[model samples]
Target: MDVLLERKSVRNYTNEDVKQEDLEYILRAAMSAPTARNTRCYSFLVIKNKETHKKIAQIHRAAQMILEAPLAILVVGDEDKAYEKYLPQDCAAATQNILLAATAKGYGSVWCGIYSNEERAKAIEKLFDLPTNIKAFSIVVIGKSTDNRPPKNGWDPEKTKYEKWK
Candidate 1:
């Protein structure tokens, strides 16, 4: 529960590299997310090269923070492996798991959307040489954070409903 509360989007990061064990732990958590029809159709691309990060930053405006992080994980979905309609949902769950797991492991992380924009998606696909069947879903930048801001309380009773809309 505390980890959930602490899971905030951290954009600024330190120079320290994330431990390999911690990276594996986060990836394990990502893979454990619930998938539609148990397809487990997501693939993870771990980007560590600064040059690649620079290229991504050039393409994704919101992903400029990714350049500061030690690593970024790109979650992709394969149309051939996933039920087409549910691919986004499965990929989103996996992306959320990565953020939560990174927080649990005492790392800061931020999720950068990719699939929502067609041009950005196409650029990313071309940059990474991803196959036509595979589509970029989201990118999670992870590293030791320099930002120390506390998490904001987001509970809102107005957004909740009972059995039906009143």
Candidate 2:
């Protein structure tokens, strides 16, 4: 609960480099996400190259945060591994786990969507030389945050329904 409350999308980052051990911990959390029918359809691509990050930023306007962060973890969904209907869902779960784990480890992170955008996905696939069977789902930019922002309460009781539509 504490982690969830504190989790914020951090776009600005300091120059500090992320340790390999912390990255491994985050990846472990991502792999622990539940999947449909136990079919783990996700794969991760870790990019630390400055040139690559810049190239990715150009693919999407909101993804410019990747250039500010030290690294970006590209979460790919393998359609061949799971049903087409469940690939996005499974990848989303894994992405949430990564975000939560990063916050717990004192790292700042932001999710950059890629799957639904056809042009962006194609550009990423070509940039990374990914095989046709796998498609980029999302990218999590991670690094030491430059500034701390207060957490906001997201709970809205008005949005919930007890049993059926009122």
Task: Pick the lDDT winner.
Answer: 1
**Pairs of residues at least 3 apart in sequence or in different chains that clash in candidate 1:** none
Which predicted model would earn the best TM-score? 1
Model 2 has an lDDT value of 0.91
Which portions of model 2 miss their true places by more than 4 Å? Answer: none
RMSD of 1: 0.9
Model 1 agreement with the true structure over 1-166: per-residue lDDT tens digits: 5898889999999979999999999999999999989999899999999999999999999999987889999999998989758999999999999999999999999999999899999999999999999999999999999988998789899999999998
Per-model TM against the reference: 0.97, 0.96
**Candidate 1: where are CA atoms >4 Å away?**
none
lDDT of 2 by residue, 31-109 (tens): 9999999899998999999999999988878988888789889999898997758999999999999999999999899
Kindly give the number of clashing pairs for every candidate: 0, 0
Root-mean-square deviation per candidate: 0.9, 1.2
